[model samples]
Target: MISQAITPRELDRRREQLVDLQRYLADQEREYAELRRRVQGFIDRYVATLGPLYMELDALESQLYCAMRYLHEALARNGLDTRGPDSPKATAMPQLLVLPAGAPLPPEPEGGLIQVGPPPLKTLYRRAAKRLHPDLAPDDAERGRRERKMAEVNEAYATSDRARLESLLLAAGESMVKVRGGDADAVMEWLRSTERAVQGRLRVVQAHIALLTNHQMHALGESVERAEKKGLDPLGIMANRLRAQITERRQELYIGQRLQPESSLTEAFLRQREQRLGGGLSAARAP
Candidate 1:
């Protein structure tokens, strides 16, 4: 249930609440942007120092994994009996299943891909564009001002930035308000709609803030801060860890190179093939 009539005091309170929520949401958004910027700065610095080796390692690992999977599938398709006496199941296998380095990897088995925006954001953008399109302005000067605002709107929509779109819509709405001339019922209706929009935008902003604060990169940044407090270089530590893995992998590959193909290559191929097939079966069986 909702009230149809509104007192002056209630309208004022709603106006103040809307303003406060907008300000708080803006501050939160700025804080999130700053945090993201700092995280990216750290990543850029780290990459500048170790990017080539890191990329090479990643490529090598991916190539190896793909080749192994391909060989396994080929063998199974050919009806090869892998459970024979000389199979990998009867031999000692080396630790070839190395885990990925600390850096984030792209999600696997990618399928669904789409561009999506919140319904509220899209509605606000449509409404704002209806009211603020530069071509609709009466005078050249006003048109110029609207042209600039329209640019902002276009950029916000391009990025699917909900906060920026909401702010632009609020600003445009406020500018159209005539404090002295409107009918009371019309003004009240406008107030109700504005209140709903503001409250809806505030919820979106708060959810975005929550997501940013709890993001993996944000958590990593906090970890780095904690490490700095103890006089440790967290980025350097990560670099050293990756370097150590690279050295170990190089050594393993070197040893594999020296062995006969029938020995190391066959063993590695069989082992990886078994693991792949077994994993597929296990996943199929999962509840």
Candidate 2:
């Protein structure tokens, strides 16, 4: 059923594509890691210069966003969807854990709700693990293959990535069939299945690269790079922006405290809300 001339050419092409994709993915990952390091370094240096107010302001901004999110969710739960039809879905805000200058960064999130993947994902992982456990392999080569596949399986399960789990299953099944089958029909089946599995993985890797390159943070990094090219201090620019925000927030808090004696809590809250809204509208309208 399979043509011999086309099979070798197709296989070689696929192999080249896979290698290229893998290398590009590796490069993208390295670039992203470097960007994160630069950003973190800038933040650490800038925050150290600002003393405790910068950290306090950062915490206040986080709390305000969380409060807004909670309010929106509560309203939706009560069937009061205030969001317009064209409004984009709310993205979960990033929460930075600001510690003292010498304090260690917090551990990664794990266990409890964070560790709970979907039931079907867990079931798939168990099935794949049972079949592909490296301990069950009879030879070193097969064991190595199993080890790599098992790592992928574990990662997919941990992330609750159903598509990746299914693709791995399909790839594993194809590999098993390719090893056991010898007839023409079986060879064709193996070729087709293997191609599909590779293509599926290619799509996933391509999408991941796209996401990394198109991320807002990555764009910000690009802007910083451009500013540096023009001999501008990008870090200083960012620090100035942060300093302005902190000053404004501190002024608002000071105003609130001054009004506290003359106004009730609800009245004070309303005044703060009005000030924020007016400030936002004015900023939006400014050239």
Candidate 3:
């Protein structure tokens, strides 16, 4: 069996391939960030505009359902409804949709084990602290900036986040790799581990991007954006439409409330809602 020889040429090729993957990963992550920002912004605006109206509409529906249910029971007490047992016991509570959370920006790993120098994580943390510590700042303004960064460094150190420490060090213009010399097999192992970590992050970025793209809200937001480009107020238009529905539902609730327990409209109203609300609200018969 021939022992696999790690050559300089082979190492260079691996470095180049890893660089390409890292570049692609960075681009994907950037795109994901921007996409999340836009989609979340759209959702926020939409809810701000239309959310109250929807709540009002649902409340009106609930009142109508309750009114109808009371009348239905009244009819049953009077032996009016021949339509037997199949009313929805109660209204189904609607579930709300929550936005997908942002994916964490993982750092690319960089370090050296030149004859096993001090523990890498501690070394990286010290490097980050030295660079980011607020006391090193020459001015109050710079000190404030450094303070925030220093907090991050402290947090990274407390949690033993090697990659985070390395990232902080890199951001402060500190070099992460400090190899005066190292074994070929060790270098190969480091390279493979880094590649695997990067590849795993790439998958996370891709999946998050897919999740944002495929969300129903994304398409709605796109439509709203396009409408805005054309000088159309799609959200405003939707708000107006909802207001109209609210006014109409209010009138319907008034009528339902005014409806005599034996009025023929009670039966018709229940029939109409049976299909709309899965007919579980109540079954009623009129005189």
Candidate 4:
């Protein structure tokens, strides 16, 4: 809403602040893009190297759990499910399902989209240079200010910082004689709205940058890089651990398969295993 008219100095200050925020927002976007590329690179490599191994491990786990369930049901048949009939039933156990090897795992869900508004205005520096070239200055004092401001615009243009050039143009325009019968208030309102839009976009970029920094992929990438710097092979180490686990699971399955479910030893083994696996049956299925 329109209110008291603002002094030129106050208006220039606000425009300068808006331009600074716009430049910062641009930097944040670049940082986020670079970070995403780095994190995704790590994830792509990790999935390619470990995806199949994980699937195989999961399959073995499913089979092992299914065997345990079978043995438990067998015990129930013989009235050995628990100490008494009042104990929890076998139906209370989680259901473990085996998935096909070719199934693809779903990616981690993301939050709302990043809402960056219109692109930066370009070629404004040339216009600013033509208008505020300092040669057009009427006196030494004004010429010096014009030269300094023109230098700033040149630097902004070189770096593709359009906001800086635009603000300098508006600031320069503010010092000129008023145009006849013009709507300065409406023009000022438009600039204020533009500032608000840019501020909103800056906030969105900042939030997204924070999100990317906090993501698990970023942590994983850091750890892997740190390992490499130390001359260690983290990926190989992970693969070795998984291989070791696969070997243990295979041994357990082998012993379980050979033992008769009716035997006392089989009952003891199943009871001990009951302590190990915990979580939804759905947890057993993943890429």
lDDT (CA) per prediction: 0.55, 0.53, 0.71, 0.62
Q: Write the per-residue lDDT of candidate 2 for residues 59-174, one digit (tens) a residue.
A: 65554444444443444454544321122233332222322122222222222111122235566777788879999999999999999999999998889887788778766773
* Model 3 misplacement above 4 A: 1-4, 80-181, 272-287
In candidate 4 the C-alpha lDDT for residue 128 amounts to 74
* TM-score of each model, paired residue for residue: 0.49, 0.40, 0.61, 0.57
Q: Give me candidate 4's TM-score against the actual structure.
A: 0.57
Highest lDDT against the true fold, candidate: 3
Model 1 TM-score, all chains together: 0.49
Once fitted onto the true fold, the runs of candidate 4 whose alpha carbons sit more than 4 angstroms away are: 1-4, 7-13, 82-182, 278-287
* Number of colliding residue pairs in each model: 0, 0, 2, 0
What's the C-alpha lDDT at position 94 in model 1? 15
- Model 1: per-residue Cα lDDT over 1-287, one tens digit each: 01347455565666577668667756765775676577666556656656765775665555444444444444445543343222222112111121122222223211111111124556667777887899899999999999999899989988988678777876776322221112334444655665566566556656655765665656776787799899998878877887887675565445433544345365554455446447321111112
Error of 3 at 55 (Å): 1.2
**1 or 2, greater by TM-score:** 1
lDDT of 1: 0.55
Off by over 4 Å in 1: 1-10, 46-51, 66-180, 255-259, 264-287
Tens digit of per-residue lDDT, candidate 3, span 1-287: 11158666677788788889889988998898888888888888888888888888878777876776787677778766633324323323222233344444333334442332334677677767777788999999999999999899889889987667767777789753541124556666767878887888888778878888888789999999999999999999999998998898798788778888778776677666556555454444444
* Residue pairs in clash, model 4: none
Clashing pairs in 3: 88-280, 274-279
lDDT at 217, model 3:
82
User: How many Å off is the CA of 173 in candidate 3?
Assistant: 27
